[model samples]
Target chain A: MAKRQLLLLSSSQLHGYEFLEFASRDITDFLSKNKVSTVLFVPFAIKDHNAYLKKVEKPLNQWGFKVEGIHNQENPVDAVEKAEAIFIGGGNTFRLLKALYDTKLVTAIRTRVLEEGVPYMGASAGTNVATRSINTTNDMPIVYPPSFEALKLVPFNINPHYIDAEPNSKHKGETREDRIRQYLEEKDSCTVLGLREGALLHVEGYNAVLKGFTGAKLFVRDQEPVEMKIGEDVSYLFKDCA
Target chain B: MAKRQLLLLSSSQLHGYEFLEFASRDITDFLSKNKVSTVLFVPFAIKDHNAYLKKVEKPLNQWGFKVEGIHNQENPVDAVEKAEAIFIGGGNTFRLLKALYDTKLVTAIRTRVLEEGVPYMGASAGTNVATRSINTTNDMPIVYPPSFEALKLVPFNINPHYIDAEPNSKHKGETREDRIRQYLEEKDSCTVLGLREGALLHVEGYNAVLKGFTGAKLFVRDQEPVEMKIGEDVSYLFKDCA
Candidate 1:
C-alpha cells in the first residue's frame, strides 16, 4: 500500500536536498527520512518557470532522489500520471486551476494523490489545493470560472503566508485573522489555518501535527486558535465537532 | 488633438455588431454611438489566442475601422509605439499581468496611455490594470509576485462582475459587501468602485460620473452606496478622504 502523507510547507529554504527547496524545510526532512527524494516540479502554474526549474534541479539530485521537470501545459494529464511524489508550488491557484482545467490534469492529480497516495507536497497554492475551498488567496482575477472548488486534499481551508497585522496598517485594517472572523461570523463552523513560513502540516493516519515552525495560527470560526508546537500531536486540532 | 474618450465594457460579446459579438452591451453601444468602427485588442494576457483573434475581426470591419491585434508576448517592444486606442479586454488579469510584466508592456502601456494619450479601456482584468493596486481583485494565487499593483488609470480599485453573495453562500460566509469593507479598512484612504456589469466610470476634465447601466453600486467604508444614472455627478463616493 502506498503511504499517504501531505507536506504543506511555508516559503523558506529547507535543507537536506536543494532541488526541492522552494517548499518548506520540514517537508524536505520528511522526504529525507522517508528516503523518497525523486520529485516532479509543476511549472505551468508559476510565472518564473525557468527560475524554479533551476532552483529544484540541483537539490533534488543532491538529496539522492532523481528530479524531473514537466512542461506539458497542452498535455499535462500525461505528465501527471508518470510522476511519483507531486509538488505543486505556490503561484496563482485560479490560473493553476485554469491551466489544469485546460489540460484536464485536475482530476489526474486528484486521483493520484487521493487514490494512489503518492506523497503530495505543496507550499502556497499547493497547500491551497489541499483545502475544500480557496476563496482567500492573495492574487488577481485574471479570469473567473463560475465555480471554484479546489483539490480538496483536506476538509478545511488554509490561509498560507499568513501575516500578522503590520504596525502601520494595524490601526485601520483587518488582517487574515479579521477576514476569517468575518467568514466565521457568517459560517460559524469553518476550520481555517493561518500558516507562516517554516511551518508544515504533517498528516499520517488520524493525526496531524504542526512541524518545524512557530507563530502558525490555526483558527476556526467561534473558537480561538489552539496553540500548536512542532512534534506535538494534532489530533486535538481537529477533534472538536463541526 | 487625440480623442481622450475611452469606452470600457463588462465582459461579453459585442451586441448588434456583425463581428466581435461576444462583448458587453454597454461597450458596443458606446462604440456605435461614437462612430468607432474599429478596435485593436491587446491579447497579451489571454489563454486562447485564436478565440480572441476572431472576436475583433468582424465588428471592427463592419465599423469600417481597420483592426489588428498586437500580442506583446509574441512580439517586440518597438511595436507598442504604433498602436492607438488599445482596448485591453477582460480575461485573466494575472495572466495579462504576467504577460505584461514579461514583455515589459506594463511600462509601454503606461507610457502610451499617459504620455501619448492613447484612448485606453479595460474590462474585468482589463479594468484591474487601471488601478493603483490589483490587490483588491478576487482571483486565486497561482503565483506570487512581490506586489499586486497595476496602472492606476483612475486612482481607484474596480470590482467588476461584482459578486455580492451566492444564494447558497449568502448566509454562510462574508458577503462581497463585507469583503470590500475590509479592504477599505485596510486601505484606510483609497477610492473603491464596485462597478457592476454595464456600469462605468467615464472620465473627462474634472468629470468622473457613473454612466450607462443602473444595476451598479459604489462603496466607501461605512457609507451607503450613492446610486448612478445617465447624467448624475458625484465626488469620490467616499468623499474627500479617499
Candidate 2:
C-alpha cells in the first residue's frame, strides 16, 4: 500500500483571515502534489450541512477540484470509496463522530485513507477525527457517540485551536494546559499534539511535519510539553504514538 | 416528597479568594439552617481524593459541621443514606461521573438528594453532575462514564465557570456562549444556565433562585439568552428544562 497522506489543521479561519484563507496555499499545494481531482466533504460537525457544504465547495472549486458533500450523495460510503480526496470540516466533535458512526463511515473512510492512500484533510473537529480518539478535543459532549474511540489514523490525539494560559486573566476556569494535563492523568500511554490557531500537521505516512507560521506544543503523559518549531520534523510522533 | 434542597456553585474558589471562601457565608448558613450535623463529602472529581477532602473539611469543620469523605467509607451507599448533607468538590467532570458510576453511587446519592431531602452542595464538576447531564461542563473528556446522564436534581444543566467572549481577543476558538448554543441545537428542550465564577444557584425543590454577587446568562433553544440577576427567581427554568 502507498503512504497515507493527511493535512490536519487547527482551524479553518485564522484570527483576521477569510474562510480557509490562511492555509489556502498549503491546502491547494497538498492536493495538487497528490494529483487529487475530486474531493468529498464531510459536514456532519455543524448543524446546517448544506450551508457548510456551500462554504467549503466554493473554495475547493476555485482551486480546480470538484467538491461534493457526502451528505448530499445517495451512497455516502460509496462516495468515500470513490473520492480522490476527503475533507472534514470543523464544529462539535461529538456530533461529528456520532454522524460518522451513524453512517457507518468510520470503516469506509479508514479503508480509503489508510489502505487505499486517498489524501485526507481535516480542520478543527475534522482534525480531531484523524487522531486516535476524541478524548483530547475541546468541543463539548453535546451528543454521545457509541464510544469515545475515533479513527486511529494518527497514533496520538490532536487538540485543535489550543491556547495557552493568560498571564493576568481573572477567570478561574481550567486553562487549555490544565485540561490537557487532566487528560494525561487519565490516559498514560497517549500523547497530545496541541495545535494552535493557524498551525497544522502535514503527514505523509510515518513522516509528519509541524508546518505553519507558528510552532506547536507536544504533550506526553508524564513529561513537560516540548515545542515543535515551524519546520520541525515530527515523524517521531508516529513512532511514540503507538 | 419535601422540596429537594441543593446548592450548585460555579467554582470552589473565586479569583484571589480562599478555598470556598466566597461561598462561605451561604454554605455555612445553609448547613446551619438545615441543622446538618455531619456532611458527607464526595471528592471523586480529582485523582487525589484525600487532598480534596482535606481542602473542604477544614472550612466546614470550622463552621461546626463534621465532614467525612465518602471514599474513606466502608460502605459508600450506606454513608449517603445516613448522611445529613452531601458535598461534591470540583475538578474534572468526566472523572467525577466515572467514579460515581464505578462505585455505583449515582442512584444512592440521587435517592438521598431527591427523595430523602438531604441538602446537597456541589462546586465545578460537582455542580455539573447535579444537573440533567454532564454535557454542559467545560472540563475535558478525560474519562468516559457509562453515560453522560447525571443527577437530575436540577431541571436544567449547569455550565460552571462560564466565560463570555473577550471583545478584543484574537483567539479563533469557540467561546463558552458558542458551545452552549451548539448544545441547544442538539438538545432543544434543554436550557443551560451559564454560571460565572463566584455565582451559584440555590435550588429548593421545584423553585430555584439565582444567588451570588454576579448575574448568570440563561440559554434557551431558538431564543436569545436572558440575563438572570443575582436575586432573580429561576423557577421558570424548571418548566423549560423538562
Candidate 3:
C-alpha cells in the first residue's frame, strides 16, 4: 500500500499578492518533490470551470507543470485514477462538495490519494473537503450537498481562512471562535484545525507539519484552543477516532 | 381560513441594546394587534432551552404576554396546535432546523401559521427558518439538518444579520454581497431579502412591510441589489415562485 501525501493550503491568495503567489514556493516544491509533471485540477468550487482552469494554468504553467481541468474529461473518475497529481482550488465549499458528490469524484479522489499515493493539494474549500467533513466552513451554504461528509482524507476538520474576532467591532454575529465552539458543542469528539491565511499543512504518510508564514490553532472537544507555530509537527492530530 | 401573520426579525440583539430590545416596539405591537395572550417559544436553536426560554420570558412578560417553551411541552406538535403565537429565538440555524425536523415541528408549525394563522415571530435563525429555505442564513453549518427546505411560511428567503463588505479590509473571504450572489447563481429564480440587524419584516395575510431602525437589501436574479428603506411596503416580494 502506498503512503498518503497531501498539502492543504489555508488560502490560494494572500493580501497584496497574485493568485497562489504567497504559497508559490511551497506549492512548486511539493509537486517537484513528489516528481509530478501534470496536475489534474478540480475547479468545481467556482461557477466557471473554464475560467478557473485558466487562472490556475497560468501559474502552474509558469512553474513548469501542465494543468488539466477534471470538468473537461468525459470520465472524471478515470481522470483521477490516471492523474499524476490532484489539485482542488478554492471557492464555495457547499458548491464544491455538491459537485464532487454529483460527479462521483469523492470516493475516486479519496482512493487515488490514499491508496495510490497521488499528491493531493487543496486550497480553501479544497482543504475543507480533504478533512472528515465540511462542517466547519466559513462559506455560505449556497447549495445543499447530499451530505456534509467529505473525502475524509484526513482525521480532523479544517476551518480555512480562520480569523480572530475584532475586539472593538460592533458586529453582533458570532465570531469565528464562537462558531467553532458551537461546532464542538455538537461534535464533541472531533478535532478542528483553524488554519490561518498564508499557512499550509504538509502531510507525508502518518506525519503532518504546519508550514508557511502564519500559525494554526488546534481545537479539541472541551479544552481551550492551543496555538501552534509554524514548523510544528501536528501529526498527533491524525490519530484514529470514532 | 385565517390569514397567516409573521414578524421576522434580523437579530434579537443590536450593538448596544438588550436582547430583542431593538425590535421591542414592533414585537409588542404585532402580538398586541393579533390579540395574542401567550407565546409558545422554540428554544432549540441554542444549546440550553431553559436559559433561552428565561431570556425571552423576561421581555414578553413585561409586554403582558405569557411565554411557554415548546421544549417543556409533553408533545411539541401539540403545543404548537394550542399556542396563541409561535416565537423562535436566535442561535444556530442548522441546529434549529434539525430540531424542527427531528420533533416533526416543521409541518406542524407551517400548517399552524399558514392555515390556522398562529402568529409567528422569528429572530435571526428563527427568521431564516420561516422562509422558503434556510439556504440564505449567515450562521455556520455546525449541524446538518435532514434538508435545507424550511417551513416555507413566506414566499421568499431571508438572510438575517446581512452586512456589507469592509471597504479597506484585507480579508480574502467572500463578502456578504458576494455570498448572496453565489446563492443567486445556484437558485436564480428565488428572491432573497438581506435583513440588516435592527430591521424586520412585518407580514399580515398578503401584505408585508419592512420595519425597524435599519434598512435592508433586496436581491433578485440577474439584477442589481435594490436598497430598501425602513417602513417600505415590500409586499411585491411575496409573489409566488418556483
Candidate 4:
C-alpha cells in the first residue's frame, strides 16, 4: 500500500512567506497540482472564514472532488474511510474543536488518517488538530469546553508564525518571543515548531522534510528554541518517536 | 535604620502601555497623588525619568523629600541599600534585565529587598522581575539569563493585557489561553494570572488581594484559561511545582 500523505498548511495563502510555502499559485490548483485527486473532510474554519464552506468547496470542486460538510450523524468514518484524502482547513481552533466534539468526528478523522492511512491535510486549526495537543496555537481561548488535545498526529507542539523577539515591540504587553520563552521555561521535552507563516513540516511515512528555509526556529517549552532550514537533517517525528 | 523603599513601574512611555495609567485616569492620579513627608531614597531611576518617576514626583516631591535615581556605577549597592523606597520602572524587560545583569545589581536589589525588608513597589518590569521567571513576558526576550527566582511576591505567571483571542487567524497556533492551559497541564499546583492593565495583585504578607476592577484570568497551559475577577479567592505557588 502507498504511504498516506499528510499536508499541513498553517494558512491557505501559499506564497510570499519565503520558506513557508512549497508552491505559490492557487490553493486548489496547488492541491491538484500535487496530483492529490480528492479530499473528504469538513472545513474547520473558526475566525475569518470559520464557517467558510465555500472556500473548501471551491478547492475541492476545482480538483474534481465532491466535498460535503460532514454532520455528526453522517457517519464520518464511512464518508472518509474510502476517500482519497481528508483536507481540513483552518479557522478558530475553539470553534473547530466544538464542531469535532459535537459531531464526534475527531475520532473518525483520527481513525481515517491513522488506521486506514488516508491522507490527512489541514491548515491552521486543521494543522493544530494533527498534533498531539493544540496548546501551541497562537489563537484565543475565547471559547472553551473540549480542551486542547489535538489529533496527536505529531507528538509535539507547533508555534506557527515562529517569530523571534524584536528589541522593541509595537504592542505594549508581552511579545510573541517572550511568551514562547516563558512557555519553554516549563515544557522541556515537547518540540515547538516556530514556523514562520509559510514554513511547514512535510511528513510522509517515517520521513519529514523542511520544505522552506533554514532560518526558521523551533522551540520546545523549557528548552532553548533553535533555527532550522530546508534540507537540514530532520525526519518525521511521529513515526520514529512513537 | 530607614529601610529602602522600592518603587517598581510596569513599563516606560515608549511602549503604548502604562499599567495603572492606561487602565484608568483614577489609577494614575491615585498612584501619583501619594504624599511622603519623610526623606526617601530611590536607587533605580537615576539615568531616566520613566513614567513612574514622572507621575509620582508631584506627590513625592511635595513632601519635601528628594527624588534621586541610583545610577552611580561607583557603588549602586550603597544607594539601593539605603533607599527608602526602591522604585522599578517599566520598560523592555530585556533592557531592565540587561542593566541589572550588567551592573550586577540583581544581587544587591535582591538583598536589599529580602534581607533588609525593603518596602518595594514594582510596576511592569518590576512586577515581571518579581516572578520566579519572567519567561511569561510577551515583550522582547532581550535578556534570557534565566532569573526564575523572583521576589516571590506572587505564586503564578502573569500574562498582561489579557487579550482573549484575536478575531483573525485561522491556524492551530497556540493562543495565550492555550499556553496557560498547557502550563497548567504540566503543573497544576501553580496558578496563572491573566491580569488586565488596571488590575494589581497586592501582596501584603501572606494575604494576596486583587485591587481594581479589571481583575485577572487563570490558565494552566494545555487546559482552559479562566477569568478570576475581584472579590475572588487567590493563592501562591512554589518554584519546584511551576
Weakest 10 consecutive residues, lDDT, candidate 1 chain A? A166-175
Q: Where is model 3 chain B poorest over a 10-residue stretch in terms of lDDT?
A: B233-242
Candidate 2's TM-score: 0.98
Off by over 4 Å in 2: none
Cα lDDT of candidate 3 equals: 0.92
What is the Cα-based lDDT of residue B80 in candidate 3? 93
- After superposition, which runs of candidate 1 have C-alpha atoms over 4 Å from their true positions? A1-3, A12-25, A32-37, A72-74, A167-171, A236-242, B1-242
The pairs that clash in candidate 2 are: none
Considering summed lDDT, which 10 consecutive residues are worst modelled in model 4 chain B? B1-10
What does candidate 4 score in Cα RMSD to the true structure?
Answer: 12.2
Fnat of candidates, each listed: 0.17, 0.79, 0.65, 0.07
Tens-digit lDDT track of model 4 for B51-113: 445555554455344566555325776767666556565544544655666677777867766
The model with the greatest DockQ is 2
Per-residue accuracy of model 3 over A54-137 as CA lDDT, tens digit each: 999999999999999999999999999999999999999999999999999999999999988999999999999999999999
What are the iRMS values of all candidates? 15.4, 0.8, 0.8, 9.9
* Clash pairs (backbone) in predicted model 3: none
Better of 3 and 4 by TM-score: 3
Q: How many angstroms is residue B223 displaced in model 2 relative to the true structure, after the best TM-score fit?
A: 1.0
True contacts kept of 4: 0.07
Off by over 4 Å in 4: A1-4, A14-36, A47-51, A63-65, A71-73, A187-189, A212-215, A221-223, A236-242, B1-242
Return whichever of 3 and 4 wins on lDDT: 3
